[model samples]
Target: MALPVACLFASVPVYAGEEDIYFSDLPMVASVSRLPQRLADAPTAVTVLDRAAIRASGARDLNDVFRLVPGFQTYPNNTDAARVTYHGLSDEDFSPRVQVLVDGRSLHSPLFRNGMNWALVPVALEDIERIEVVRGTNSASYGTNAFLGVINIITVDPSVVRGFSVSANHGNQGVRDYTLRQGGKLGEAGNFRFTYQQRDDDGLKDQFDWKDKFTSRLFDLRADFSLSERDVLEFSAGHVEAVTMRGRLAKSQNVLIGGNNPGWPIHDFSQSSTYLQAGLRHTLSVNSDIYVRYAYVSDWASDRYLNQSANPAYNYDEAGDQGVRHEFEIQHNFVPLDKMRLAWGGSWRNDAVRSDTVFRGMSWVSRDVFRLFGNLEIKPINWFTGNLGLSTEQDSLAGAHTSPRVSANFHITPENTLRIGYSRAYRTGSTVDYRANWWEGSSLNFRGNRDLQAEQMDTWELGYLGDWRGWRMSLDTRLFREKIPNRMIQVQNQVEYMVEVQKIQINGLEYQWKWQPFDTTRIQVSQSFIRIDSEFLDSALAGPLSGLSAVPRTNLDQLGERSAPRYSNSILLMQSLPFGFEFSIAGYWLDKMKWTRNSWQDRYSRGDVRLAYPFRWGPRGGELSYTVQSFEGNHGEFKSYGQPADRVVGRRHWLGLRLDF
Candidate 1:
């Protein structure tokens, strides 16, 4: 395995300032090795979304966060219904292709088709330490659900924070938000931190008006007790409470049609998550170390309809879901021979999910996964290095899969490097696809497919990186082909008022870029193109079925194309100003993409800007900022079956303030 990138950048103390050490530095992890290497020394593409850049972009949520990073696309009808996709295999109502994690905890709901509940994640932008985005397939290193990419959100360590802060913002569409955070040390051996945030917005469209809110309280306690100079033990726990209202579906059939319909009844939902991790590290020798870690996760959520029609015959409903996961990981590093390094690790995870619908009953599922992987690093020349790795995972639903990866870095000159890499990745089938119960003529019937298979991808990347004086720029592009066999979709047998479950396969390509012209300026851009085709397998099917079908296709399916986007890209720019101030601007463009098999295309372009100033008052510190989001005021449209396919929604703007002591 390649040594942590920290070892290489440790000697390069290009910035010598107190704030540089705390606010602008990347975490010391091995994942960033390819970033700092010269453009001529490596052949793989990489993008780094630094903390300062993220803060300057004025992104309000994770959807806005991706606006600054190229190659990733976030689709949010409103604050509550948001989903991200990579390489163009996405649906309006499903989990994304990429995997999202915050401080090593997955943000996906195992019972809801493995999709994310965007509204429940209460991470304040101010508390983010940094975000590491790995584009291209990385299942070999991170495991399943990493078929497209990995987004790792690293938070601020309590020990490094010594004060408190608070912030509030109000904007268009009745948007309002407030956040508070505090951190300090207890004696010399213990450290703790806590944060809470709430957000509510009326949204851009009439029917789309909704509320997105979450309150997350986290506690991290760390104590160092040394039995000897070479041993240490650490423990930590994090908890979060996120609540949101699901927006009204564009499809009328799914909406309440009778009296007292407040346009759309709020779908009250909540997600509570808790995580515990414990680790022990030991140094066997001056150049070797071994560690063991055990982690546990508990997640629960409930979605319920509020304020039903007054008619006694009408029925209101609620659905509750709960899941628990336990993981064990072990890793070791050693120099068994001269000038050669080796690192290896293995992990095991088990997840159990249970769900119940008020009108239906209850269902349960259990899944277990185990993985083992190792990497070796060797230097063939003083400036040439190579890394090779292999991993295998056994999933309860998808059987077993093995992936092999290889990468090389070559230092051609002092200022440039070249990187090349290739890997295979796969995504396990979602539980939502295997087990679900949609309403059937006012009655409920369970729908499931036990034969669902894992989606797989083969990825290859090439890239260059460079650094000189105060200017640094890097570009990474990838060519990939993914085979999503047994891909799930909902098929309706209208003749019998019954729905049949089915699957299909798809294939595509993704490309992205990152650049920095000066220490205070940065820009990023990316695009994805895909081609999807499907075939039906149910014996009840008749003639020929051609193109891909959007999940839960409504009347919209009759108007457009299926499951593919022609192209999508985002551009972002940020620059620091005088007086602890910063300025930022971002623009997003989505090409005309088909909503259903024959629905008309909807295209849109949006932009946002912000101005921020950081200062201190008495013994406290604070930040006053004003943001104008959706400055372009573009009117967008959402298409759905059985609903007017061309309804328009307007844009919005907002401003906010923050304080810390």
Candidate 2:
């Protein structure tokens, strides 16, 4: 647009003086322990999804922007095979207890140990520039699955993305999309950016069936360099190629797929992913600093769920899974004595996985991990502040572990704050729960258990923060309690080497609010209440649960309460009109839930709508939009209990355009 707004002001100034062009009266939150503070002194519970709340939330993937995050829960299915969770321990899909990152690497992959392949998310929400969301569980600063939450993702700084852009989108099932972006400058200290994306869909359709068929293409790049005033550098890379559709989901033993039962052993797999990362920062003074980062990733997938004529000797013939990972990290930050601030780091990771269908042969199959971490923040006076964090981990396949966190903060001014925290976490097993061996030859089999052990948790928290600025408002709150003890579950036909165990507890409250009394209106609200209690502790070595149907009593009793939603709420609104035209709305409320146990899906409320318009020609600028999803029409976000057309979900509309040069 206008040459990226005239190279974003040729040298500087997009937001230098601030007049609240849209939001952010003040904002700074950096994944809790990776430093950068002041979300009322972080330490836990942080959320920020800036960029005018992602352009007023007309979200198109990126998992629908966490449905406006608050105890985040996703799994309403629009497909790219979606899954997301935070406060609700969602199960059976890639989310594996949530921890996601972009700028700080880690996109969690050992081939979907628990989650996050959402069809190869390699960034393209207009290069997302913000999305913090730490919302709890700091396994001592991100080790140990970060236990229940973390979704960092930050982008945009390529000298502020100087120029070129394009975009398009089209509607209804089978939607199509495209994007292209480019940035500039590389002299006088450097800068760079790039993007390319494509999409295809036709996934959730009504009238009984039509399922998850998706396609993707992506490429991303970033570069920055200063290499002077004490060094600075950053680089990133990405690639993705995809195809999707994986049906055969028996709704946990219910068998349904509409129109005279369609979804049969559906297939269509193909996948690819790649990554590269780099980082360097050095500024050894002014309070100290040193940092390093590295990342490498590779992934591949194939499908036809293995059959080579039913295991033609089983060496490999496309079933899926291939992964590689390498990570390295280093850090040092200090202020040894100035009201204190300390950080220490260590990390090393390696994973190699191969699968012929959850582990059979193709070789490669490795795992290694090592970590050490430290965090400290202190004030010791003047309104208090304290924090401590630790992390230690070593694993070849679950062994040594440690995670800890402690905090206290009370500011009561500077807009108010209060907090208390505690944390501990560990969760291991994934790589198909330590090596799955789902032998398909003899009709079926499931086995994996390299003597698994390492699911433990303990958490506690209380928090509050408030900002008024004369009622241009903000408020946040949290209360939590959690407990877990060996929850592994991966069984089929009872249990044995496959896995099963449970013990859970969770109690919670979370609330959020933001308001901008004017300046083209804005409002956001979030709510969550949770309660989950489960017990099965290896039900006598586990039995029962073999293709459910005895309705009214068979998902083995709430079994971890399916896709969560113990209680939830979300509201969003954005407004500005009269000429440049724009408006938005969102509402969601969910409660009743289940995804394959006790088959149910009652509580529901969904609404979404967006409209936009803006134009300019001489210097370029663009916008055009329309979106409607559900909007309270034919809705169903996964229901079960037999013949519900197997998880039906629908309602959609789209139309979009963007341009800038």
Candidate 3:
């Protein structure tokens, strides 16, 4: 690709000097305009991840910190429950199109099939203080899983935390983890923070035929309150519980070669989740603000498997699921003139789901959504900047919709910018995609379609942002195209249902570059280049469908054009090593892809490293670390259907200790 963009500027010059691109030194992104702006005038394309790049990317989860972001994708497995996607339409087991917030609370639930269960993520990565990631299609500022992207996750502000901490991890496949934190001062205008965590693993070792494991636990809390000088209140709560290791193993134990399907063997996939949130914000001057919020969530799961062939119709719990949510919101931000700026909001949500074993005799399959959003931002000259957004949804399961977006940046001089955008999104179909009724004892495999329809997309982009702070470098690029005329495919001619049939198209070019280059080095690089195309919408088959390799459209347009990963890359390097020691390295590469539709994954590579040391026993501060995951040793990013060797991701190794009181 132009020799990796000419070896990344061969050490210099890739546009600089507009006083070295400083908009107060960039980085402000508020999930692409609920109004924090600046990330070169955000109207999409953001990817912050700071907290020192999430502890320099040795990513112990948070879905591997999105593999350092460019068109993200993930698969560290931890025995099922980790899967992230960004430019891909993934689902072998859920990734419902992105949108996973935390501070604003929506974790795409319907009990995880609507996605967002990176092993019950209840935040504890040292309290995360950053991670914006908006990339594209924000469903007009958050609606319907943001239709394709948005992951806010802010955290860390219990009055900027102060207090105790503890941490631990030990690893190598059965990697254990632990954490505890506490912050104080909750009596004079509040401030609080608390956390507890645990994680365990043993997954993907020659991977999948059972005995891959996981365990989890978390509790969390946050508080803030300063309710007077213009109000402020905030609260949070969290929980997560888990156990995983599910299914597979048979074919007379030769691990599947012939057809003697003994697939539901190892069980225990229980899960639990809970959440709460509250907010109030007030400050209606100094350029205004107002806010209100509420949130709640609940989830449960079970896996019920038994039937060592005495076949009572396979004894089903069929992976039970439960779900819940409740939300309310209100917001307002202002400056309505003086070069405009605005943000408006409204929200109401409800969403319930219960399962009589996957909805066969459903009881609570509720849905209700209502939203109204707005965004404005104008800058009228001083080198232009404009943005307009809209959202309006009223979805009682796939019904009303409206999403819009528009952008234009062109700052072309105060540190380089140039953007152009367009958007139109809609996606709503999940209460099992409009009520699934999956039965198995009497055999009705899949069916759900209360006339499901709400999958539309359209995007177009061209962006660039550069800040060279005289070679401390920065860059972000995007060049997209997305179209999804109506895609929602879960086909299976003789049994399954839920169809909207494909159209899909995606074209991409992603970028990210960063460099500190001195003062103890740092660097980052990212790349992507994708292209996908799909088909199968000839009114979705009734025989005259000519191709897609036949039988139920078998390859399904090569599974949506290989499901994203037509080249991918990531790199990170941290440095800072001498006496107080620190080091890092992160790497990834991908090419072969497709995570389902008869799996096919191959070209993947990984590398990770970390080393640290920092100590002081006097005022107590500690750090002592070591990590190595995959270390370029075993690979396979996920693939195991008719297994022919994939799913192995070995190497591992860990040791960490935090302590600070």
lDDT of each: 0.58, 0.74, 0.78
How many backbone overlaps does candidate 3 show? Answer: 1
TM-score of 1: 0.81
10 residues in a row with least lDDT, candidate 3: 1-10
lDDT of 3 by residue, 1-661 (tens): 0111112112211112211221226665667778766688788788777776678788887888888899888886544567788877775465878888888887878866677777788888788777788887898988867888888887877876788988898977788998988898989999999999888887677443445777889999989898798887898888888887766666544455542235467667888888898899887666777789998988888877755565455667754767889989998877767778778888999888787766877688888888999989888777888899998888877778889899899988987899999989887767876678887666788878798788898999999988877677888899999999878877766667667778998998999988776867778799989898887777776522433345447666767888888888999888888898989888888898776676667787888888989798888897989989778687777775665565677888889999888
Candidate 3 lDDT at 315 equals 60
Clashes of 2: 8
Could you tell me how far off, in angstroms, the CA of residue 281 lies in candidate 2 after the best superposition? Answer: 50
Tell me the tens digit of each residue's lDDT in model 1 across 1-661.
4444234433322212423422233223334222233223322344555566677667777666875554565655443355666544454344556777765556666645666666555366666766767766666666777667777776665666667777888877677777766777666555666666666665556443233433334333333344466665666666666555554532345453444344245465666777777777777766577778787877777764543333333333333568777888887776666656666788888877776552235456777889987766667576676767677998877689987778887667554556677777677766645555544235454455556556656655655444432344444455544454344344434311112223333344455545566677766666665555554445324411223244433332321124445566777777788777888887777766544333333677878788888787888777778887677775553454344423344566677777776
Per-model TM-score on C-alpha atoms: 0.81, 0.32, 0.33
Ranking by lDDT: 3, 2, 1
Residue 299 of candidate 1: its Cα lDDT? 78
